[model samples]
Target chain A: GIQVEQSPPDLILQEGANSTLRCNFSDSVNNLQWFHQNPWGQLINLFYIPSGTKQNGRLSATTVATERYSLLYISSSQTTDSGVYFCAVLGGTYKYIFGTGTRLKVLA
Target chain B: SQTIHQWPATLVQPVGSPLSLECTVEGTSNPNLYWYRQAAGRGLQLLFYSVGIGQISSEVPQNLSASRPQDRQFILSSKKLLLSDSGFYLCAWSEIAGSREQYFGPGTRLTVT
Candidate 1:
């Protein structure tokens, strides 16, 4: 099984601040995605990046597959961004393994 | 456009009770469907996945089972629920080929007492 680790288990940022969350996996992955679990417990897909960089609005993500690491960037954070961000990867298997997640709280 | 749906949004059951959760996908054919559980303060754990109709695979041995009777429908069932079964269950779908970016539904919150 591939081990997935996420850094900064907890983060608190002021509205308008920027933050970076990281995810590191133990093995090569064919698929990698970032998700946001909102306060109501709804899991929202943010980015699906196995490699290269992608941007969506004020959020962006970069995955260096060769290094087995991924980074999620949130710029101009808002109170609505407060929630748990998860990084999940699909290896050689059919299932996707998830990281422990990074809990983010943006203060208004 | 593709969308995944799961229901009921929330459930409460007693020990040894039966459980059934339904998931369906629209606007996509032959997509891969998956079921995952997110326990309290924990990450999402893959429970089952189906590549096609009647082709189901279980990731971990548990009290639950999954069945894909239709091309775009997936179901999770348990004859006897356990206390540990309580959690947020999510249904996701992905393309059969390239990218494999899974799109998740709103999820169902189940509490087994």
Candidate 2:
């Protein structure tokens, strides 16, 4: 079984600040995605970056498949961005391995 | 354009009680459906997945079972609920299979007492 781990389990950032979250997988992956679990428990897909870099608004993601790691960048953070960020990867099966997650708290 | 829906945004049930959660997808055909559970302060766990009607694959063995009576409908049920079942349940759908981005429903919060 492949293991997925997230770094900086807890994070606190001020409004308008910038932060980076990282996800590391123990094995190679064919599919990778970033998600945001809001306070209401809704998981919203953020990015589906199996490789390369992508930016959406003030948020961006980079997945280095060769390195088996992914990075999520949040710039000009807002209070609404406060939530748990999770990265999931699909290796060889239909099932996805989800990282422990990075809990973020943005202070207004 | 597609949408996923789940019923009973929140639920409180007693032990040994029956439980059923319904999930439906609109505007899509032959989409892959999945059920995931998230414990308090923990990551998401894959419970079950379905590729088509009457076809399901279980990832973790437990008291819970899933059924897909229609191409776009997935149901999670339990004859007897356990306290360990208290968590957030999310229903998701993907266009195809491996590596595709999954779109999730609003989610249902279950508390078994």
Candidate whose DockQ is highest: 1
**What DockQ, between 0 and 1, does each candidate earn?**
0.85, 0.80
What's each prediction's clash count?
0, 0
lDDT of 2 by residue, B1-113 (tens): 89999998999999999999999999989998999999999999999998889989999999999999999999999999999999999999987754577899999999999
lDDT of 1 by residue, B1-113 (tens): 89889999999999999999999999999999999999988889999999999999998899999999999999999999999999999999998888888899999999999
User: Native-vs-model 2 lDDT?
Assistant: 0.94
The residue pairs in collision within model 2 are none
Over 4 Å off in model 1, which ranges?
none
Candidate 1, pairs of clashing residues: none
- The RMSD of every model to the true structure, in order and in angstroms, is 1.0, 1.1
Q: For model 2, report DockQ.
A: 0.80
